[model samples]
Target: MAGAQTYESTRARVEQYFDRTATRTWERLTSDAPVSGIRATVRAGRDRMRDLMLAQLPQDLTGARILDAGCGTGALAVALAARGADVVAIDISPALIDIARRRQPEGLPGRIEFRAGDMLTPELGHFDHAMAMDSMIYYGAADIAGCLGRLAPRLAESFVFTLAPRTPLLMAMWRVGQVFPRADRSPTMVPHSVKGIARAMRRAEVQGNLRQIERVNSGFYISSALEFRP
Candidate 1:
């Protein structure tokens, strides 16, 4: 709740960009559909990152309730459910949520539930663990920390999320994106240093030991994940 207004503003931009403009692009990218070489690298990077996060968790997730924050087209949700995890996959984009619900396989009625809304909504109930893949990239460390501060109370075990690294290339790209804003383009991602994020987390009074995980880089895609546990 520290940067409520800023977080909400970024959240709205993300929702609008994904829901109104990038639905088909995401659907195709998340699928086996052919894409350009650069996009192929992005797809590969995301796959590896997803697997990396999954590997950090227990193999048998039976009875474990997980929040798949910003689950795009249901890949992570489906994978988590396959491991017997009860997953609540939420995205801000209703269009993407529709695709996710449709892509969700049958016979796993309660295995995964798809919803379109804020991931911090208390109505989604508590979770043992949560994973927010590429969801907080558009927000700064302060806003990211604030969002986590709100979500920490409902999470009993731990949560993991990815952020754009504060590399020179990424910073340049961010600046360019801001200067030449396009209505159809995805919102510009704000890069953050690990130390900056940690400081923000401490200032927010979010009780947790923050750990830096691996960074994934493939062509145009570059991201690092951070894990927090009480």
Candidate 2:
């Protein structure tokens, strides 16, 4: 039941956080760490989510128009362009958009356009597919539904996004973490359960399916990807 102001405030905070840590996030997304430890495990989990999303995309993206909603540092945008999909990448953080534009690969068959703005309100053209990796974690269920309601109409095929899983154990851990003082806690990291995701998707009038991806300690489900179609 968060109001528009609440959602906007949350997004503003997230934008600021990402603006400050854009470079750090870029490194994490493209790092080459040792392949057998905590860092490796974490990287593998992230890669799995990205790979799962990429797998859902059409193999032949020639002349396709793809929307990279909430495209953090343009990693996925660049990947889509490499596959011959014209990509329009949007993010709330100007710094992240700047980095994305700077890091854009040269001589790709498809073009990439980076924009700094809210995904829900951007006046972009229609697209064949949309992907919002790891970015919708900032919004509440209601806000997510609102975003989908706005975005679904502009897509010709489907939309894919990731959300932090809201299991009981994970919620308890989150509460415990909030009880303590932490400098690195993101104010916008709102996790949603699978049921919550479904409800939001339903509210947005989209058919949604989820696949659990990252599980930690074999107990807490860390995240999942949701694919939606009209």
Candidate 3:
């Protein structure tokens, strides 16, 4: 797992990117407004990814407690709540959280508690199952495992999350992103291999093995989901 300094630095950059730089773009992308073809593909990909995560959980979550970690704009949170799962929807960007709150419907079958903060926070309490979606795609493998280590103790059954898969094209894009001026750059999406993640998790007491993996590829968006279970 990443040392505190390295993990924190990456986290700060992510906060800046989501909270300021890409806030408007994200807001628009998550909306129904027409977007460019590339963004449309990204939207479709995200939808597929969300459905993929939901498929891993119980269909009737009547009494289940779930943490929609990095619940950007709250789509996943809303869906979970609609299925009767009490959901804690968290994100680092307060602006996004505001948007998510505004988008939430009245009288959902299950309640949603929206908070803007790190998803790995202990104070958020424990859950039956947790999902981080595309949230950890920007961190290094070890840092991702550090996040998993922290959240693992809070989970009773499973934690499903996504990582940018290591691929030739993604590696090339990562290289290109490193050349941009820091102020002008978005947080880099660090691609990772499953084997690399397993190795990193070995350093932490995650106490789980990856039980499932799925990939979604839609034009500009590509992500891989892994379910970690104790």
How do the residues 87-149 of candidate 1 rate in per-residue lDDT, one tens digit apiece? 999999999999998898877634998999999898999999999999889998888888788
| lDDT for position 91 in model 2 | 91
Top of the candidates by lDDT: 1
By lDDT: ranked, best first:
1, 3, 2
Model 1 TM-score relative to the real fold: 0.96
Q: Which stretches in model 3 have alpha-carbon errors above 4 Å?
A: none
Q: 1-230, model 2: which lDDT tens digit per residue?
A: 23478778878878877777545655454555334455565566766777788888987799999999888778889889989999999999887887788788799888999999987764787889999987888778878777766776787888888887776766776678668846566553576876776677676565445445443332222567877775
lDDT tens digits, residue span 7-42, model 3:
888879888888988989999999999999999999
Off by over 4 Å in 1: 108-110
In terms of TM-score, which candidate is stronger, 1 or 2?
Answer: 1
For each candidate in the order shown, give its overall lDDT on alpha carbons: 0.90, 0.75, 0.89
- Candidate 1 least-lDDT 10 residues: 101-110
